[model samples]
Target: MVLDIIFLMLISSTSHVSANSTTVLPAAAAACSNGECQLRDECSTDRDCAAGLYCLSCPLEFRGSRCVRSTISDPFKLLNNSLPFNKYAFLTTHNSFAIRGEPSHTGVPRFTPANQEDTVTQQLNHGVRALMLDTYEFKDGIWLCHSFKGKCHDFTAFEPAMDTLKEIKAFMSANPSEILTLILEDHVEAPYELSRLFRSSGLDKYWFPVSKMPRDGQDWPLVKDMVANNQRLIVFTSDRSKQETERIAYQWNFMVETQCECFLFSCCFHLWIGL
Candidate 1:
């Protein structure tokens, strides 16, 4: 499979906190060290936990970081896989491509980031299923920038969107059963060129065709269907011209209008599609 190739091409390059990995408490619970946690009995920080557990502060139902699981449970995993992709809710990030005030782990250097310190890969790994990205044509590349200027910031700088996207591709390659949605605020003069990035990153293989997508008010295909066929990646853009190509899906046509109003340039949503 094409993903198999991508997996190999990027496997050695991808960097993420493995799911099975654990960490220490936020602050010092008591300055506990490996000696105290060696038996998997005590943990001062995430690193103090054993190989399988992470540190979490919980109530009486669950105590200590490594001793027990979190009292909370992830509801999304309990959803029926047979439901259409749109029927389920997803987590999304605003300024998905921008970092808070530091450079991203997988993007170009920048003095100032959009709003978050975490990179796209970090967000995705943390369970954000959708992203709100601003796309603009910079000096030679299509980069992610903040503001209507669509150019590098006065003090901060724009990051090459492709870099973030390639990492996204890497994440998708590794997590096949998951689905991702990209909502792009278009500021680029030309949108068709985005396809080049898709091809270059090898994400085109995972592209969910707009033709196959459901219209507003229409139900979407099941998550199993999308994952089974490897159509787990979906893209939507504010620029309608981009829709001329197979890679970009015009957002309004697919996601119905909602009471949650947004300006033309803003792309982030609390939860945009499905119930």
Candidate 2:
């Protein structure tokens, strides 16, 4: 019985040692080193860190790894103290309306041809400050090839749209004093692929998508380089969550620090206003 007690004690002691070995103490994180640190994932600025964790400098407005930033008092401040809505006009083909048939005796106005330009002009008169173009090829008389009944035709085979864009660009170039903001959607492909298309079209001075936040960090060096190279592409991010907004804001702060143009595209305009 005495020998059994000794064995039990030995087992208990072993168990205690194992438990102690696995126990972790919560304390201040360590300083960052060579882009490595204890709180690396959570580190945005030195202020976000505890005693041991290395505090890296965050871009303007960004506070921490969680990417917290204060809201601007005015959305117009984002557009160089000018209202984006007032400074430019938006033009697009998607919003154009078509008239399918002749007017009937019932007094419904009908026409055979769609007056795309007239519709766009009306929108321009209403104060649209930017243009968003959907560049996907249409198939079978459908602009969206993925849709039903569009599989038989290819839209990219046509050149009229490209020519039209060139004319518009030329016109905008002539009126350089007017602010011209162009928003391009990639239509179901990675942004990098769209970058190639822009390059091929000689449109390097447009906005492109980036995965990095606009701050002076390892992740943003490429974005800085692109800006330095006069790529003329602004970084636009689409964020859906508060956490994501924080992260995007941090990156935006970094971009803002570098004087790069950054914009956010969100579905929840109301929520963004609250923020």
- Please report the candidate that would top TM-score against the real structure: 1
Q: In candidate 1, what are the lDDT values of residues 1-275, reduced to their tens digit? A: 00000000001111222222234444324545553443335466767655444454434223554433212222247776787665565556667666655444335555553555466777777667777778777767777777555555534445677888888989998987877878888877764577777788788889889888764345677778888999988888888877876448887656532334444333323323321
Cα RMSD for predicted model 1: 11.2
- Cα RMSD for candidate 2? 24.8
Question: How big is the positional error of residue 251 in model 2, measured in Å on the Cα after superposition?
Answer: 15
Off by over 4 Å in 2: 1-115, 119-127, 138-161, 188-193, 206-275
Model 1 misplacement above 4 A:
1-76, 104-113, 154-156, 245-247, 256-269
Best by lDDT: 1
Which residue window of length 10 is worst by lDDT in model 2?
Answer: 1-10
Q: Backbone collision count in every prediction? A: 9, 17
lDDT for each candidate structure = 0.60, 0.29
Error of 1 at 183 (Å): 0.7
State the lDDT of candidate 2 residue by residue for 120-214, as single tens digits: 23333333233433334332111211112212123212222244345445544443333333433324233344344445555555433344322
